[model samples]
Target: MQIKLRLMVALLGLLSVAATAAELPELIFPEGVGVNIHFVTEHTNDLDLIAAAGFKFVRMDFSWESTERKKGEYTWGDYEELTANLEKHGLRAIYILDYSNDLYEERVSSLHAITHEEQRGTASPQHPKSIAAYARWAAAAVEHFRGQHVIWEIWNEPNGYFWKPKPDVKQYLTLALAAAKAIRTQVPKAKIIGPATSGFDWPFMEEFLKSGVLEYLDAVSVHPYRDPGTPPETVTEDYKKLREMIGRLAPGGKKNLPIISGEWGYSSSTAGVLQEVQAQYLVRQQLVNMLNEVPLSIWYDWKNDGLDRGDNEHNFGTVTADLKPKPAYVAVKTLTHELSGYRILRRIEMDPKDYVLVCVNGSGGCKMVGWTTAKAHSVGVEMPFKSVHRITGMDGFGKGFTPKVKEGDLIFKVEQMPKYYAFE
Candidate 1:
C-alpha cells in the first residue's frame, strides 16, 4: 500500500514537472490589428466600452451620402463627432469613403433614397465625371481630416453587394485607381487600402494586381467570413490562400504591401446554428488570424442590429443591442490579455483539434509553449516543460479567461467554442 501511494505521488510530480518545463508561445503584433465599427451613429456610447475591452483600432465608414447631401457642398458633422469620440477612447480610425451621393447620381435625392438598383455600378452618363469630381473632393476631405485619420479605404465590398452589376472588377478598379491617385495627390502621407473585397477570394484581385494599381496603394483589404461554427483550421486555410494570392500578384515575391482582414466575424444567432457554436467559431477565427500573421482584423460591427439580417448578422456582434459583452467578446478579451506583451515565435503543426503556440516573454526571454486543445485532442510540442496551468473561462468553456502562473509552460484542455490559449 505504501509503495502504491509513493508511485501515485511520483506520477503527480512528473506531471507537474512536465507542465513547468512546457514553453509558452509569444504573442506578437503581426501587423495592424483592429475592429470595425459599423452603425457608429448609433453605437457611439459603446466607444469607451470597446476601448476598455482592449481593441487597438476602429474602422468606420464615412458614408458619402451622409456627408454630402447637396451638390458640391460637404459636411463633416457626423465624422467630427465620431472621430473625436474615437480619439477620446484612444483608438485609431480606418475611414471608408463609401457609396455614391445623390448629386453624383442623376435621380436620387440622397444616397439612402437610392434603390439598390439605382445605386449599383451602372454609372449614369454623368457617372465617370461625378466619380472623378468626387475623387477630388474626397482628397480635400482626407486633407481636412489629416492627422485625425490616416488610413483610407476606397469603398466597401465593391465586388459583392456594393457592386450593382455584380462583380465588375474592371469598373470598380477604374474608380478605385482614380480615387487612389487623387487621394495620394492631396494627402501624400496618407495610406490607401483598396478593393476591400467581401471575401478573401475575390475574382478580380489578381487581375487588379497585374494592372499596376497595386503600385499606387499601400495595403490590400479583404473581408473573409465563414460560418462562426467553422473550425479555425478552415479559416487558417482561407488566410493562406489570401496570402498566396497576394504573393502571386506581387513582382518576384517582393511585395512588401500589408494585408488587412478589414471585416471578419460570424453570426451566432443565425438559424440552424447554436449561439454557443457561433461564439466558439468566432474565437477560433481570431486565433487563426493571429497565428497566420494578418496585420489587421476588424469584427463586422459593434452592436447587434435589431433585425438579425437572416439570423447570421445578429450573431456577429461582440455586444448585444444593450451593450452587454457576449461570449465572443469575452473570448477576444481573454486572447488579447494573454497575448498582450509577447510575440509569436512560431505556430506548430499539431492536429486540427490541438495546436501549440510558442512564445517568449519580452523581459525575461523565457520561452513557453501554450498547448490549446479544442475538443478532446492531443498534440506534441518540441519544447520540454516543467509545469502546466489549466486556465478556464469565466462563463464556462468558451467565454474567455486568463491563465495565472508564476513560471512554467501551459497545457490547456480547451473545449468547443473557446476563444484561445496563451503561454507565458
Candidate 2:
C-alpha cells in the first residue's frame, strides 16, 4: 500500500511539470492581420513597406475575367507575379477567387456593374458553363499554389452590389458549392472558405448556412462593415448571433466554428470619417475582434484608391495614394510590433465601459491593453507580479505616463484612445 501511494504522487508531479512547460496560445495579429490591395506589379515598392509594417497577409482578387480571357484556358501571369512578391516579403496570400468573366456571362464587365438592378450585370458567374468553368479555375489555382499555404475564398460580398444585378442567396450557393466541391476534390488539403457576404446580413447568411456550406468551409468569412457612427465593440453581439447560427447549422454538430473578419475598414474622406478617428477605430476594431476570438482580421484598402479627397471609396487606405503613412498605418505597426508573438491570457475586466486584456508572450513577459469608449476614467489593472512598467499610446496621445500604483494594482487612465502597458 505504501509503495503504490508513492508511485501515484510521483506521476502527479510529472504531470504538473508538463503542464508548466506547455506553450501559451498565439494571438491572431502579426500572422493573421492583413489589408486589401488592388495592384500587384504597380506597387512593388509599397509591398516592401507593407511587409515592414508587419502585415503578414495580403487579400487580392484573382478575378476570372483577368485570368481566363479564353474559353477554358487560364493565364496566371499576374497572379504568379503577385504570389512571388508575397513570398519575397514572407507574406501569405488570401487570394479571392471572385468576380465574373465578361465572355462567360454578358459583354458587361463586373467593374462596370453598378448597384442599380438595371445596370447590374451578372457580377458573379451565373450560367452553368460559367459556373463549371469557375470551379475548374478555382481547383486549378489551388493546385498551382498548392504548397504556398494560400487561402482561397469563394466570391467577395455576394450579398451586396458585388453580386451584380441583385443578391440571390440560392444562385450564390449554387456557384459556391460547385467551386468548393471542385477544390476539395482536386486539392483536398487546400484551405477554402466561402460566402464572403457583406456585413452580418442574417437573412442571406442564414440561407447560405442552411445549405451546409460550413461543411466545406475551413472558416466563415464576413466583411463586417458598420455605419460610420457605429462603434467596433457593437460587433460583439453580431458575432454571438453568428456563432449560434453556425453551431446550429454546421454539419455533424460542429462547435467553435472559426470566424474571419475578411474585410473591414474606415474611410478618411471629408464626407466619410476623419483620419485621426480612423486610426483610433483601426486599433479598437482589431482589439475587439481579437477579444471575440476571431482568427483573422483584414482591413480593406492598403492604400488610398484615388486622389479624390471627398470620395469615400477613394480614402479607405492605411496610406495615401502617394504612399505616405497615415495615422492608421502607424497604429497598426505599433500594435503588431508591440504585441509580437503575444497571446491573450484573459480579459481582466470588460465592464464599466473600460476594457482591459492581459497578454503574455512565450518569454514570460506580460502586457495589458486598456481603453474606454465612455468618458475618461481610472481603472485598476493588477499585474502578474508587482514591477515597474512603461505606458505607450496608440496614436501618439499620452506616452511615458507613470500610473499610480495601489495594492499591487496599477491605476491607469482609460480614455477613447487605446493604450498599451508593458511590464518591465
Instruction: Give all candidate RMSDs, comma-separated.
Output: 9.4, 6.0
* lDDT assessment of candidate 2: 0.78
RMSD of 1: 9.4
- The TM-score obtained by model 2 is 0.89
Q: Write the per-residue lDDT of candidate 1 for residues 123-221, one digit (tens) a residue.
A: 321358777867876787788888775478888887664644354777777787788788888877776787788776546777777666776776778
| Candidate 2 lDDT, 347-372, residue by residue in tens | 77457578887766655556778788
Give model 1's TM-score versus the native structure: 0.78
Error of 1 at 266 (Å): 0.7
